[model samples]
Target: MDVDGRNSTIGYGASASGMTDFSRTDAERANPGHDTRQSFQGDGMRGRVLAIALTLATLIGALPVAGSLWVAWGSANRARTDMLDGAVHEMLARYNRMSTEIDQVFDDLSSLPLAEACEPVGLMRLRTAAYFSRGVREVAVIENGRILCTGAGKSDMPASLPLPDMSEGDVRIWYDRVPPDVRAPASDVARSTVIARNGFALFLDTEQIYDLVLTDPRTVLSMVSLTSRQVMGVRSRPERAMLSDMVDRFRTDPPPRSLRVGNRLIVAAPTADGAAMALAAQPIDVVLEAWRQQAVPLGLLGLTSGAIIFWLILTLARRGDTMGARIRRGLARGEFRVVYQPIVRLSDGACLGGEALVRWQQRDGTMISPDRFIPVAEAEGLIERLTDQIIEHVFADIGKFLAERPTVWIAINLSAPDVESDRVRGRLDRLRKTHGVAADQIVLEATERTLIDARRAQSSMRSFRDAGYRLTIDDFGTGYSSLAYLATLPVDGLKLDKTFVDSIGSGTPADDVMGHILSLAATLGLDVAAEGIEHGAQADYLIARGVTYGQGWLFARAMEAETFGAYVDGRMAVAGPPSRRRRA
Candidate 1:
């Protein structure tokens, strides 16, 4: 019975142990279906949280980024559009100004009686007008294919005037007179249309209108143009584009409440009944360029901030400092000096005077030429002070020289601004009194370029001369020396420009031209002084041909006060061959 029971127990135990399967039960408990579903749900929740965080970040960053970009792009585009539009508008404004000026000129011309137009008084008036209107290359009154009158350079055009074809419309709107080449057919001869009273026209060259309009920077300004759509007479590529775009966009439809081209914004108006359009372009590019340049500073500030931030974060930034302050401080120390160059008489080799030339000495003792700093000084308004200092020094030197030699003359080349200022005259008067120097002992050499206002110059010079001061016209032949003005002006002498003197006997036509000028000056009783006579031959030639005086290297280069004094004292000798001298 015990054996049977033991065997049954063993069998039961074995079966129970085998059926239990502890590892399989543990696996089933750990991975129950409900638990698996809950695990998958947890993982999905985490993934959704990550995606939400990423999407939130993108939204946070991209909104302002896109908005700012849109605002910037829109502003830039508007500014660009405004600039282009403004360019056209400004061009039109310039055209209007030019047109007004032209009308005024015509009015002035017409106001003159027909009889006076050809007289000397008329010529004087015309020449005065021409001088004031220097931009006008030429002026002519053409009547029936013949030039009725001209101020200057009239022979360059055809002797016989040519009339233009005017089938399209009245050509008088564009031209004052017609050339003979474009004269209308005898059968098509219409009665001359009076454009501006005395300003009448028989025909107009459409080509000349285009040429005139295109020459001005304000008209067909520097711009890109589309060749295909260009008007018949419009030569400017940019103008063509502007005109085409304007016509295409604004011709049919009224202008928008506001329009922009480039950076300029402007108002538009229709022109010429139904055929033409006009727009005014204001200078928006300047403003835009300024704004754009400002961004550089802002960007630099941003970079500096970023660098500071980076330094704060990484602890690896350098100190922010520069040498500009030190350099400025050095400049404030006043380390500038002046040198003098003597001007002398050519005939007697007499030291007449000197021009004070300034120099800048750096802290390191390196001297900088006046040409570099003089412009800077002028722009900064420091030139007046500089000039005063130079004048004081010069007057002191002159006083010292005159203490021994009273007959010597000193010429000072004054800047245009100085010459224009009343203070300069006052200073000269004070200097004359202080130095006991007669006004004739000091010569003021002024250039024609500096004489911008003839009336003012005439008045100023007359006053100076009346005060016993001598005035010399310097660089005489270089500019538009009008014969009419030269004949009328009370200038004591003319300084023939170095360019003309240099060109003399160079086998160029200019030599004969200069000879004619010399003759003209002699006839007018004006003293002629030849300038830049570097060669003895040139000086001899000038003196032989009645050139009264000369200044050049042939006699001497500009020298120091001591050397010049020695030359005046007959100690330093000039090594040139004797020149044929003439009296002034």
Candidate 2:
């Protein structure tokens, strides 16, 4: 048969059996050319092989990324646990100090030869004991919960003590107390924790018990009485339900443990005496944030082995995932820059120095406000990196200028975590040494909130001052602090908050506070710098009140390093020194 006729008649039905012959042989026989079944099987086998190859490739590509994510998550969880453990350890150390002091005071008081506690000799001995005790504010002799006499003197009247908050055998504890003859302000006297036993009571400061340096700022520390389920002392405000649950868990004096309660991770340890417990609580989201921070580098490292498609998707997703991620990327790309706001003498308007303020600008020429990104950086524990970048940029921008002008000082803001850590101080010292910048020429500024642990903050600032670096409190009066709180911090100057300056001459209650702040600064002999002084009247008011330094729009807004250098040059050319101008 011809090839065309055979092809046309292929797979035809109705053979001798009068049934359709649907076999592949019929087609193959009619054509007498290729094997149709073999061709079909070969194509199917090729498809199966290709699918298996793709599947294997996908699994191989995903393994690394999956491993990275697992490792990152594990590290984050371990970090959270470690942080909680640290906080608990710190609280226990505090408790140990307090308990040791209590034991010492009780022993000293017990050894005193006292016939009558209300008499002159006994009062003198009590006073001497109180003088030596660090935690004891007052030592008193009590009878049936009534104060008979104290180190201050004999009570004019018998003052009845309130019922104890925690009573265990012979020991009694009052969580909050205000005894008679506490002449200090009501606020100061309200936080006293009284521990009484064997006819004597020691009025202890609650701060001694609860002032802990928590690893995470959001972590809350508290001392709770396991028996009474009452909070003996607390550092920051805690959720009501969380506190209640925590107290309930320790009713039977459980051993030290870390457990998740609702949305918080709580690490708790009991006091040595088993009467009280210390707990540190942090949010779960904070832990997840820590995970995200660790995941960035890990994920990048893993993506090298991932499929090109996955790499592309991850890159695009991370590009806009979070502000923290954006900041991290921005820092890597050198998108952060510095600007200087001139600090001038209120008397002559001659620039004495400038404050280094950090600014962020993306590659696309988009400006991100400090108010927006700063909090994100803080929350993500990237503030130290941001501060490092700011410091580097500052020195690069104006290090030589500062070296030439001995009188000019540039103030740099320090975040709370920076104040808590030694990294920033070390970085600053190295930069100063490298750039020939005088320690005094660069002022380190910390806000009131930076004093999270007042004792530690004081020690940190003292180290700075000892190194000859000046310290200033920025944004004063904006936090939960008063002028008196300044005495606790080792600082040379304070920048009045803009809100206080804006309320200048507004005849509001804040005006009164401003007056009080000025008076307090003057009394303390602290250098006062008024911020946001936009009006002559405001400047005049501050200058008249003896504010020597001021920075605001009245003199000039923040400018780039080049502009600021020219600004100071022009100011010096016109105004000269106050002494020189007066002589002229």
Candidate 3:
């Protein structure tokens, strides 16, 4: 039979039998062509079946391979995030621990009697030297651009060391770049010392901090006068080198503010004294070099796993999958709202103005505390928007309140970052204009930390004052630079920190401290507002002490606008001693 004829015959039976059978024995015997044709047909069928099986097997394997790959990629990303978070947390912990240590050291130094530390005779010098001599590289008494005496081991000192007429920048350059001959060693580290003056007397006993240059081990302490722009004393070469490097780095990038450079971290913070000091630490670059050293094996494993994951996901997606996307959209869509806390006169309980507090309401109807999100918002650059929204709400609330009552001043708390920005002043100006409100009607409450840069703070405060806005130093007693800041900054009012009020009349030594603070504010001729006043006795005590304003749950808790309006209409009266409630 011919090939075409045979195929035509087989085609008819192939549909029903799903097979082909050769029954012509004579033809098979005459030609081996029949067997060859049958063999070729059998091979073709097997090949097709093998191809289909291989393709299906490949797809099945790819699903798990893709899934594994995706999982691996996610794991790698998560690991990196965890590592970075751990590093930041560790750094913060170390920074806090160092701060505590410094505080303890300052406390010890402050506890010493000033009379003993600054005796007219050399006894004070001897005592100072003796106190720090064991680990001290040098000790010098600096007063009015002159070094009175030195405990430096070198013979380079004159009877009286008159400071060189150099600018602060010049001094820093000289100190940082000078040869080791002038610098101190690790064993006898050189430090620059200066006495900070408060009015006429040196403020030594009041937790006053002095600038010191020390070795990496923190052994040798040197003092410098930033005002005088000169080194007061010297010590060993190795110590001086380390101290100079530290001082230079500090001048460039100071503490609380951290800058990362390659594998090293440099941090600088201002001394209780005027000088800026810095510390540097180098962390091993394990993450960056991980790929070259150990990443091949890990990456191969991750890649294989990731491939499996990718395939699994692709299969699931192909099978018609449903997935949800979760994202955190911040306070952009009216998630943040304002709550008003009334600031009232302690004597009459007359509500002067309400401070606008921000509250975040989540989609789930849960209210997130300001303490949690405010910092995050600030970090995320959402503070500017947040501030604007707050100002708008405050002004609107003020407008409503003013329609019913006489003009009242509203104080709004600003973050240090916001207050420090030049744009803040402009924003405030615009807000004032938009609301048709006078600057006096709105008080900006900034903490001492907000005024870290004295020059900038002075400039900003002056601008606010010139614009006719009231500025209050918020949480006054809690800051390190409160008293010194009050003397310098242009502020109209002082808001006593809550800690002081909470501790009042507890019959503890802290009460005496609080009383002194109240007296101090009164002496300064600044208006005082006792914040967080909870008890009647505390309120009465504060009122007697001439605190003009008070806030907290003592008189009334923070209420809604309607409730506050009613309270104001009723003019809730507070009975107290006239002395305590005296208005400024």
Expressed as tens digits, the lDDT of each residue in 1-584 for candidate 3 is 01100111222111210111111222333553432211112244345544554565455444443454455555543444344333334333332333343333333345444334434444344334333222222333344443344333223442333343343431211132211124556445332322322101111221112222222332222334344434433221223444455554446533335444444333334445444332333232433343234444444544454456456544533332111000124344565555566778877777776666655554554444333344445545566677777777666666556534435666777765556666777877886676666666777887654554444567766776777777777766553342433556677777776667767768876677677667667666778887777778888988888888887766665555667667665763343211211121
Q: Is candidate 2 or candidate 3 better by TM-score?
A: 2
Give the clash count for model 2.
0
Off by over 4 Å in 3: 1-279, 282-304, 307-328, 421-436, 507-512, 572-584
Which prediction has more favorable TM-score, 1 or 2? 2
lDDT of 2 by residue, 34-151 (tens): 3111111224434564455566546546667668778899898888888877777767766775676677678767866445776898898788667555667888998988898898
**TM-scores, one per candidate:** 0.55, 0.57, 0.54
TM-score, prediction 2: 0.57
**lDDT tens digits by residue: candidate 1, 314-415:** 221121112222223324565533444444455555555544444444554444333234444544455556556656766765566754555666666555
lDDT of 3 at 119: 49
The ten-residue window of minimal lDDT in model 2 covers: 14-23
